[model samples]
Target: MAELSDGVAIRTITFSLLSSPGLFFTFLTIHYIYRSYLFPYLQPSMSPAHIGVAIFALSFQITNGIAIGGWLGSYGPTTSSNWAKHDLSVYLGTAIWALGLGLNVWHDDILRSIRRRRGVVEKGSGEKVYEIPTGGLFEYVFFPHYFTEWVEWAGWWIVGGVACPPARIFLVNEIATMLPRALQGKRWYVSRFGEKKCEGKKAVVPGLI
Candidate 1:
């Protein structure tokens, strides 16, 4: 079997490789919440519903992780020889992933910058202020970050190829969960900024919701 950069045998797209991007994304999210949102904007508290949803989502993700790990390690053993043939896919997928990651960070930073510009909490009164974000894909979609994330995982799917059911399911699940949230976010933007300002923008996709 061919050895990957991690010194793991590249039999199939293993859990570590498939999961690394997700872990990185999670890291960024958690850091953003703590470093920016949580301390500055939100007062921390726990609600029953919040705990329940967190547990629910966590369980589902854990299940997906186990399934994906199991499949690649045992159920589907892609040979090193097979891996060699897909070199082009590796490079292409990496490029796609990089592009998606770049856009996601850039757009998310735009939103963060907007919030930070006026300070997260107003000085004496302590009112949180918000403004419409601009830059990058924000011009076309209310949630450009969401769309870019889907693109990031699409690259993961492509790297795994057609036979990778685990990757396929993960990508599908991400869309299913995030799509509604994006739509709701669009409604919020419309309410905050007005229908006229939000007229041309879509929920997550640019020009096509």
Candidate 2:
């Protein structure tokens, strides 16, 4: 009886940890879909190649969902042990992700309202969209969404615990690949909006990098 109870408890805990990362990433995956596929498809200067790259990057994280889910199922212990220790890092990390996501939601709503007021609908498709901005966070940073996204994965890494190679790989790829794009994006915005207006905004990190 004792062994059986322990086994069930362990299984439950492992399952929880394994599932938690997937859930966090899911929110992000959905967020990207809403923006890339559903929202516009209508950027004035956006090219087919740019759209393709965007889709590739957005889909990359979602693809990890399968690997993560599989890891939890395979190596996950089926018996309760001393491994069920609570880490405050996980909670704090999750909170940061939630906060970033919340900011994005609010920002989108504000931009959407502004577009409605401006009477700017899609060119021929009739879908509604907010135009690219020169104000708010956009006034300072070109890729706030990318910034929050980086933070979100960092949070996932924290909550998902150490030695999670899959999470580390995801973070590494994002940093290596996206960081350059972010810098380019910053330059793009500056060219469009002027550099003087973008004071005090770092490229990726707040004050550094």
Candidate 3:
């Protein structure tokens, strides 16, 4: 096997370490899409607008993966003794990302279970109405999955270093999109179940907004 630093520049190693989580998340998304077939109860018909949004989202993910990966791989590995220290942030970030991924998957499973248990089906216009999920992270936040996703990308940005332009941009985009979406979801949940059921839960954050 080739040595870890063989043919890889120090900067490349740093960049790769930072960028690896993005690629991992991209692959995880693909895996989720592939495995979606196993969960027929969770699938819903897509409207033209929904399809457009899906395509755009997928394209953006692909582009983000490419940009980060390409930038990292542009240089070769170097024979540097300081690689371990440089990789500290990467390792920490990966751990956080993994935690977030687990939470996201678990929350999704809970949502799916709720839908199946309630025999939820799509309406004539492809609308799905789900009961309030009060289990798992949903007990704390109205949109725990989205919150975990933000945590995952926050880890990504940390791994890439806060100064890295691409990572910063991605983090900004996530905040801009997810925050509003979570707020809207919170509103919808309150409207459905009234504020009593959602008494203690925040929109995305647990203790703070």
lDDT leader? 1
How good is model 3 by TM-score? 0.70
Write model 2 residue lDDT over 137-189, tens digit each, in one string: 55445566566667777776665556566667777887898789879876775
On residues 1-209, what C-alpha lDDT tens digit does candidate 3 reach at each position? 33232455334343232344444345345435634564344543322557777798899878876866554444221323333444676677767767876787788778767665544455444765668787887878888888887787777665554555666778789789889989998899899989898898899989886
* Segments of candidate 3 deviating more than 4 angstroms: 1-49, 75-83, 120-129
Better of 1 and 2 by lDDT: 1
Clashes of 2: 0
Query: Ranking under lDDT, best-scoring first?
Result: 1, 3, 2
Clashing pairs in 2: none
Q: What is the lDDT, from 0 to 100, of the residue 131 in candidate 3?
A: 80
Model 2, global lDDT: 0.59
70-136 per-residue lDDT for model 1 (tens digits) = 6545454344555556556656766776687677767766776675555635665587676777788
Clash statistics: count for each candidate: 0, 0, 7
lDDT score at residue 139, model 2, on the 0-100 scale: 49
C-alpha lDDT of all candidate models, in order: 0.68, 0.59, 0.65
What is the TM-score of each predicted model, taking all chains together?
A: 0.74, 0.62, 0.70
lDDT of 3: 0.65
